[model samples]
Target: MGTHVIKMPDIGEGIAEVELSQWHVQVGDLVVEDQVLADVMTDKAMVDIPSPVHGKVIALGGQPGEVMAVGSILISIEVEGAGNVREGSEAPPAKPAPAPVSEKPVEVAVVEPVAKPAAVPAPAPTRAAPVARQPDERPLASPAVRKRAWDAGIELRFVHGSGPAGRILHDDLDAYLAQAEQPAQNVSSRYARRTDEEQIPVIGLRRKIAQRMQDATRRAAHFSYVEEVDVTALEELRVHLNHQHGDSRGKLTLLPFLVRALVVALRDFPQINVRYDDEAQVITRHGAVHVGVAAQTDGGLMVPVLRHAESLDLWSSADEINRLAKAARSGKATREEMSGSTITLTSLGALGGIVSTPVLNLPEVAIVGVNRIVERPVVIKGQIVVRKMMNLSSSFDHRVVDGMDAAQFIQAIRGLLEQPACLFVE
Candidate 1:
């Protein structure tokens, strides 16, 4: 038999390590070539690693949630047939495998003390004198319950155990703590109760987001600009288009119109479609516009890129945006779909407030935010009329894009949105 060690492949650019999310195969299971062995998470995307050779799995590297470095031994396999097997190519000595993945939390068994029967003759003499009571021994509780009691500085003996077999439970400790903090008689104080705090481990995508936002805030000088656009004409055109092609093509949204307008405006101002290289002290202006749509999912904020947005027509852009947004919210977007964006667009839908200052997606120079649209009285041609108005809040990296250029670029978008026909023009 020939033993082969498979290492973790580089999943994406600059990804040094990945968290092992799950394993499909276990030790001693036979696996085929090109078969998925495990799934690892990196760059906020799940990547499945396939086996290289058909063999019986000999070992697994680590458990789920463990971070494994790239090029490290991920799994070992033993294959049949060894015509050219190297000398001393024997499998390493086997060690006991880890506990099965289905095992529950670690449990420490508690041994209850057994009472022995006393002699009948001695029992009568013991009643002649009363024995002194002894202090309570350590309480019977689980490790977690004990830790909670310790953290709260409450003795388990003082708290009543309500669990099965008189074991102390977490709720018992909480009740005891609460009762002890109540005011005595008529004296009341606001700071009498102790405050409990929870600690959540910052890991996975959340940790990456925190790090990236902190780095951007420290390095980039952010300048925000807000402008109001009258989108009544655009909304009218959208309603008409949806009515005409609602069944044949998908219903249109304001996003696709905004995307096309931004694409057009980018042509006039290419500086906004650029990425900054801090280490190299250089800026790269991209000709192709890959717009990242900031989508909020149950997991967190995910930005899925619409590649070559500048080349796609209005309908095609709308379709692709729908597809990408669905994939991102459902946690099915690929690494490529989530990366390589020149700029970004964020919208809060109906929940969007009057205005918001969106943070810049790192390395990119600009981000456009769409706020809630409201109908309000306005003076058009010296007459009071209600118009559908929406605010466009945008942020730019001051070091790369000047304040004047940012304002002009947004104004250009406003002009297209107000006209509603220029977006469809060539």
Candidate 2:
């Protein structure tokens, strides 16, 4: 057997170093070709590093939360054929793969605690309800299997294993899920004292979010303005369009109309659609309106850009928004899809309260925050009537945008939404 050393690849745009978010395989674990070995975090997204050849994991170069440079050895695998490893290069590989870093985390699992078959006849084939193991035994499975079990809040200890050496496979998990009965909640559990603690390291995409939010707050002079808009007409128009063409075209959401309003309103307030580079002391007013739509995923918040919003119609715009949102949530959004926006739009949907002050997406001077719509009495022509009203809580960089311009910009959006017909008019 020979060692096949895999190096940390250079994920584009001249990134020198990246954070090792998590390792899918550890030493002595058998892995197959195309199996994901680790997940690396760049500025915008999480990238999976896959194995080139089927092998047993022999060594790990870095641990979770470590910042590794590009081209450095990532992991070493033991394969059947002559690997890419050169003669007398084994010693140097050990230097980069520190003894303490690689071996520590695994000790709590199979390496030192329960199972220690070096060429591991691992347990998890797919994972179901734990079965046929001691109380302290750790179940074996692939990273993907573990993730699925984790998301469902299922404990592997009770799961039955049917694979080689009693490894839990997907079939076992499916059987368990299909056949297992839900346990009843214990009455005394509510009052029981709890001592469980979880340590989530601020690494990967989370770390980037923290750094960017801090920088934006420290560097930019942020001020927010709140305005109320009567959206009864906009909702009617959206429903009408969907009722007429939803089967052939697609269903329409309030998001598409809001995006259209921004597109139409920006024609009057071009200054709001810009990126300001503070270090270079330059303000770039882009002709193209690239809007960043914020989406929440299991990992964290991601803003996938809607490129060239000025060009697409309402249906096309909705399709693009849905597509981008899906990609971002599924961890499939590319770097280009995640970057370069002149402005941002954030909405909390039904959870959007009366008002909120959102932080500006850095370099972009403006962000529009949408609130929940509620019907309330309004005095029109000295008569009290119920109308659907919502608030627009928007923020701007006070350094470049004057108070008057910011107010006027939101007012323009309000007029378009209130009228709804003006959005399509040239």
TM-score of each: 0.72, 0.75
Q: Give the per-residue lDDT digits (tens) of candidate 1, residues 189-291.
A: 6546657899976655666577778888888899999999999999999999999997888899889998998899999999899999888999999999999
Model 1 misplacement above 4 A: 12-15, 25-32, 53-58, 78-98, 101-199
Best by lDDT: 2
Each candidate's root-mean-square deviation in Å? 14.0, 19.0
lDDT of 1 at 245: 93
Question: For candidate 1, what is the lDDT?
Answer: 0.84
Report the lDDT of model 2 for residue 67: 90
- Write out the backbone clash pairs for model 1: none
Q: Write candidate 2's Cα lDDT for 1-426 as tens digits.
A: 888989999998999999999889878889999999999888877889999999998889898888999999899899998788776666246323444455545645445567655794345354343347766778988788788888877887767777766787777677678556544333346666668999988987788789889999999999999999999999999889999999999999898888889998999889989999999999999999999999988888889999999999989999999999999888889889998999999999999999999999989999999999999899999999999999999999999899999999999999999999999899
- Supply the TM-score for candidate 2: 0.75
Error of 1 at 211 (Å): 2.7
